[model samples]
Target: MDIDRRTLLGATAMPFVPSVLSAAVSADDWGSIAREYDVTREIIQLEHGNWGMMPRPVLQAYRAMIERVNRDTSYYARRGMAGDLEGVRAQVADAMGVAIEEIVLTRNATEAMKALILQYNRLQSGDAVLYADLDYDSMQASMQALATTRGVRVMKMALPEPATRQNLLDAYRMAFDADPGIRMVLLTHVSHRTGLVLPVAEIATMARQRGIDAIVDAAHSVGQLDFRLPELRADFIGMNLHKWIGAPLGVGALYIRKDRIDAIDPDPAEDPARTDIDARVHTGTPDYAAQLTVPAALAFQAAIGGSRREARLKQLRDRWVRPLRDMPQVQILTPDDPAMYGAITSFRLRGRTSHDENVELARTLLERHGIFTVHRDGLASGSCVRVTPALATQESELDRLVEAIRELAS
Candidate 1:
């Protein structure tokens, strides 16, 4: 197989033409690649939004980092740790086209998000925090924690589906206006549930105009989606490197506006002026081996070529979607526009108790066909099956997914 691990890692050119993504002939093409990688083409594993499986080179590099660290733990930590972290931060920031000062390494998206949310030192007892109903549950839970424990008001509103960019901006605009007490907003760059891209920068503009802070949860956005932090225009941003970029776990990032860093009180009494973004939020010692692998993932992406991988994934998503779109029983919850979507999508079968049935259906698909997907509810309050495609996912597997769901629904 020319599609060996080395080949995947060594692909260095980016002939990325998004319009090249057509529904036809794609599944078979992707099928061969999946088989070459020993990834099953018979069943779809459309679940990369939660945890992206690592590329072969990334996996190898992760093991190499561990072995290297095991040889001289403290020596590596003290001798080159500072320089290495700086180098990694610079690499990551460059990947996102941001200044190195804007990037800080963190354990995961949750820590990054929490630290950003807590940074709004102006948040008072009567102040309100607004977030979309389609926001990640963990973020919602964080807001709940803030309301109950921090004496702030929390507003979680439903986001309109099949929504346009303006539709999203309207929701946030209304939410902020309805309550002058609203001091902050937590926006999702891409919803983990429906994979609908949000209007982050526009919302950020609205927030700043009103003297409020906005934090964007880019957990599922970083590698899977093409973007820069400043474009989101949020005061703060948090993302996970493990899922999309294939970094080893214990890896994510916090991006804060340089001006906002001063207002943020570092956890465990660290100074924000240090320029070590890691020092600002991640107070505890992280797994160094895992952190070290981040650069490897970044390099691997560069090698396999970002633009090519991104286009291929987009093509896969389009292929998975086309078969189900016109079916009467199928309700596609993800946006029809590529601009409003990423490497993920969601849909549902028309039925009663959609949530329970969707979960059971997902379980059956996995059990019967080796297909794996996550079923979601609560955000927009309907049962929907979430589909995330990784670089390893192939078209034949998606065909099975389309057919299997159709058969089950019928």
Candidate 2:
């Protein structure tokens, strides 16, 4: 009698578990060792780096919070609920290695980035603010809106893919070099389109050297990458916990280096030093329970082990690269360099028009095949599907994605 593969593999797995992990790794075994959270790959969910699906505990906590709030709305508010919210922010601040005094809880990275960008000392008529064309559209739109209303200049740089990190570093240098008058620089922690992980420390160093304020839109970096807030040294940094952190959708964090806090003007109102982290993020009263659940998400990250989580995501990524890296028409936009990519990777359909074709492709895959992905329509590149995986993604599941793309491309 031969033992089944699943049974044999399960007997040899480790007992350690992360509350918020999507998958577990054990020795050479490829299956998710942890109890299944039931996120099937039947349709192929390779875009987790875009929006991290919550683990069971997080989903349960979220649903319970909503139910409790609805049961006794008044009792929950104007009570000890506010303290719980603060605790969540403090834990997040500590995890990111930033002081709570300099942190602000927000709905997403875009909100935090916009709040900081709006606070530039002053944007003179001829003074310009620089950002990459790859920056998220929302952040880019905020700059454009300011440009139109404030008579400021907007300088955009279009970065190429399959390029070296120095190529990116040089692009920023070129953009700023062309116009020494560029007062502020907006950058992405990970290009949502190219999946390029930039040398943020180097970029921040250049900004300080040039006397420019660097505000980074880190919608994709936080949980997917090991980020220490204190070391980044950017004037302003915003992160979305929901993307790779596996938190509820409403939660995100902004870390302002304590010394740099004074440099930023806190939106329409000035928040006293004692105010909660929401000083700039408070858009009227929000769902306190929604905010309170963020720490649980962080706990999940801690349990999985940060570096190990990164390694697992990388393992899943390799499954795709092995098959598609050699494809001729498939332009792997993501840097093959491990230092430059995490859970997210992008590719352009060479000899193809991706814009409308990709938009339709997105809907068709999701509706017909149940595969969900980003259309990449927002970027200058017309359209292509981006695949990203969380720790929970299995090799067999990832193979499904490579097979589909190869078939489509072939």
Candidate 3:
């Protein structure tokens, strides 16, 4: 139960041996790499945006850790778990390219984001806060709560449909210019509803210039995209290891820059004067086994370089999207710009935008085509089905999706 660096590294290093981590990875190489995962034969899973399935090596490591934790019980929890957890924290911090003191593990991104949103001390009476329709539902509710809790006005905006990097930037600039009272803005790095990748750093910079604070929701971007924490240029961020990093479902991290830790109040249970980032979140009795297995997940992702994994996922997305783009009845939610999207994309029938219509659309895809997808709401345009492809997803599955859409549209 006491995990050291050597033991953690040893558990994950040997199992993954991807043939190619380069741009020109061959089809056979991708096939071999796909074999590392154990996906279900019951359906073609295209809803990986919910959470990632642990690769075989990471799954085995998790099972072993679960067994060890059960066997040791409180003996390990009381004696050596703290030290082991610090090692895991260090690993997560290193993977994120941040100092160990600046980040703390949480049960999930929602918990981390709620803590940051509720505890932020910068808001004053009559000040305004901004969020978009595409932000996660829970985060939107949390931002709405600020109106009652902090006496601030809540502002919501809609992103452009055929989004471009320049137009997106212009939208934020216009919003900030229109509302000088806006004190904080919520930015989602990649939209869960429609895989639109925001220019977070630029947007954050614009907010700062207007004396506003930006809280970033990076739940879908951290492992799905190849970038470091610093590149975001934000002092506050909440990200998930379970979504794209391939960790167990209960693991995530909260980040507060070293100088800006004071801007967020500590959890009610902790002393307000305490300066450490750990005081910001208080999750009683977290999943120790899940947390301890984070290194194995990081190792698994490292084996297949981040850039290569990103390219593979986008390739899978483009396969289905390109063929359907010309269809008059199909409406692809995400744009074709390479920098504006990742593995996730949502779409709806041209005239069908109701919740029930999208629900039926998702049902037909599953029942008729044997491909699994989920419907998402809250976009200004309307409800649509979200399709997310994992690293293990085969090109054949995507081709099947394309065929299914074509037939349905006809």
The top-ranked prediction according to lDDT is: 3
lDDT value for model 3: 0.89
Question: What ranking emerges by lDDT with the best candidate at the front?
Answer: 3, 1, 2
Which residue pairs clash in candidate 1?
none
State the lDDT of candidate 2 residue by residue for 19-136, as single tens digits.
2233443343335432334477467666776577876666665666676667668776677566666667678878888777877788878778877777555567878888877788
Candidate 1 structure, TM-score to reference: 0.88
Clash totals, every prediction: 0, 3, 0
- TM-scores of all predicted structures: 0.88, 0.87, 0.95
- Clashing pairs for model 3 are none
- What TM-score does candidate 2 get on C-alpha atoms? 0.87
State the displacement of the C-alpha of residue 247, model 1, in Å, after optimal TM-score superposition: 0.9
Tens digits of per-residue lDDT for model 3 on 1-410? Answer: 12343454334333333234222244437876676679997999899999999877677778777877898889888988788788888888888999999999999999999999999999999999999999999999999999999999999999987788999999999999999999999999999999999999999999999999999999999999999898999999999999899899899999999999999999999988898999999999888889888888887787777898888889989999999999999999999988889999999999899999999999999999999999999999899999999888989999999999999999
Candidate 1 segments exceeding 4 Å error: 1-43, 269-276
What is the lDDT for 381 in model 3? 89
